[model samples]
Target: MNKLLIALLVFLFFSCAKESDSVAKKRITDEVFVPTLKIDSTDLLGLPKDTGGIHKGYLLNETEAVYAHMIYTPGGYQESGEGYPLLIFLHGWGPRQLTNEIGTDLNVVKEHGPPALIEQKQWNPSFPFIVASPQLEGQYWASADVHSFIDYIIEKYNINTNRIYLTGLSLGGGGCWYYVGEKGEESHAAAIIPISARGEASIVSNLTNTPIWAFHGAKDQTVEPINNYGSVTMVNEINRNSPAVIAKVTVFDNAGHDAWTRTYGNQFGETGISYSPFNLNIYDWLLQYKKE
Candidate 1:
């Protein structure tokens, strides 16, 4: 009788532990959303279909769902032998409904960054990376959400793990800063380009090893140019070196909060310097770094 009782107690304990673990796993899997591997027209109305262009689809988990996000793949992505780099582009704040409600129009995402260029039929087909732009569901872009989506993208596509990049404008720019600052060395972005938003300078130490090229308008009152200037300056101060000082900020002296237009459009005005120190565009600058 004593032996039987002891055996029963052990069995119950083990069963409870197993059950707890199962519940925990299910909870985790359900909470975080993951995009479907097969991109489709589920929420793509005003957006272009995935005919070797921007593809729209839903990011869903077991429990919750958000509206469709846009992703752009290179022309020969399916046939490429080598893994292509991945660029995760985050957009700034849009219409109030875009974040507060479900089924918001997907076209708002293309208002800035690479997605806009794609919609305009101006994105170079030879561009060498896979781009994913996830819309903000709430007021801000959370780092955890960005991390999870990145994990999904890395797994879902033929991504070069060493060459992942991140960029954003306005509110999205702030998200970029928050993501890299919060994740530190684990952020996994080879480089980040933040435009028109000043992020927290308190997180400067976190950016020591990360290459950054921040842009802001000098005369802007919306988000002062000092925000980005101060952050980048602190980074350079923390890790002072010549060519080694990879973190830099470019303030458009005559421009306003809309510095992203020229930057993303790769259109530097007459005073805009586009060569020598760092040539071409932000895209080329991003491709210059790869994690060791």
Candidate 2:
């Protein structure tokens, strides 16, 4: 009788766990998402099987022919064949405009942000998202160009459209602001993390519906802290009427321009300095919202 009772408990435990997982998945499926960008299938490359690990490639652009990119797929990606969330990282000015040679310039991209973590093998292999870091040829990344690249990549992979996230540092952070402002109601990203950059106050209305979590350095002389604070404040003021989305900002008192390192490295969460009440890392914070 004891053996039969133990067997029944084990069955019930597994059944409850499976049901919880199914309900979580159903929540994601029930969320509605209308893709903002028109997927451009032209010049799409024949991608290799996603057996996992980082793959280097270049964007097929006529005007900007030398745009290089790196993609990292977590381990066991091919086994599930499920649509995975996508994280697109835009690098700042230092890594851009390198020669089109994939062998040399491509390595510059992996020196920072998510790519750096993956290259050093510090990133968790079980992390579920596919990270795409794109290098720019110009000083500033245009929203239109970024959107075109997004269209190109979606056609090239099995991305969960509703869970697409955008993140960047410095100029790339400014690029994130530009993207949402220019796209306005048509932005495709579900959330954006802009570090050490300023957003335009005039575009606060455009960001009312978008989820924003900006970061800045208190001593940042390059880009003043007010830029990030001002924009977030504007958005929150307007949200007082509807309060659907709450914009957040984390200012590192001792830090300067290089705020992206700690953020992308999850040091904030590890050191218990995260602005989030739950001490969630940026990845966890980003995953919480998905066009719902």
Candidate 3:
């Protein structure tokens, strides 16, 4: 009888756990996400499997531990030529990994974001620059690695220090915000564009000296649009007391959680034309700013 009871209790526990997980997934889908689903499970996203510029790379931290990454260099870029602008992109959450094929890390090294744009031919190679996207193993960006990697790339690639920029979407966006706040001054970043993600509200004060162009979907559920607004509002308030800062929140109406579609794709409306300074279809604006 005791053996039967023990077996019954185990079954009940597993059943409850399964139901709980389903409910949690449903809540995320129903409340936070739309009905349909389209995300890379393999995380083999970003550049085409054949795309040449992007190569798998890794960075070593103070402990000499390796952090895997995806790196992209614009075409015709030469190490001996004038230095290229550097853009350090951070990626969002990938599908849970099934095996550790790529590395022992928890997340798959997706070729998404900047790498995807360049690989898919969405980003013009004429915009000469270097993009290094580090696949993080956690929910958010790490400042220590961010600082170390940027320094490493700048030194190794002869990147124009004045033209270094930062940008990311969702988890990456939040990471960008966090990094800019914590180490923007130290890193000497030219600007940052965070989409559908914002860090601590109070962190805005720390970025009065940084140019920020934040984007968010009005109907987003995963991360509220107000987060970006809060950062912009706070920056504006603080700007009034110091050197005026440039921070804008570009809102996408009737848009879902995937603000990145327009953010990185630079697609605004049917024409993909500039709707406002907020919604831009070009990358020159980012290049407009350079550290003095």
Q: Which is the winner by TM-score between candidate 2 and candidate 3?
A: 2
Which pairs, if any, clash in model 1? none
- lDDT (10s digit) by residue, model 3, range 160-213: 788788888788887777787787468557888888775765666677788777
CA-only RMSD, every prediction = 21.3, 12.1, 20.1
lDDT of 1 by residue, 152-267 (tens): 77777777788789999888888888898889878988888887776665666777777888877667777776544443344355356333346777666677878788888877
Candidate with maximal lDDT: 2
* TM-score for each candidate, following the candidate numbering: 0.71, 0.73, 0.69
Stretches of candidate 1 off by over 4 Å are: 1-54, 59-68, 95-103, 227-245, 270-279
Residue 73, candidate 3: C-alpha displacement in angstroms: 1.8
Range of the 10 consecutive residues with the lowest summed lDDT in candidate 2: 38-47
On TM-score, the leading prediction is 2
- lDDT of candidates 1 onward, in order: 0.68, 0.71, 0.64
Model 1 alpha-carbon miss at residue 195, Å: 0.4
Can you write out model 2's per-residue Cα lDDT over 24-114, one digit (the tens) per residue? 9875554322213332222112223334475556643522433468887765555334566788898888888558777677788888888
Ranking by lDDT: 2, 1, 3
Error of 3 at 21 (Å): 60
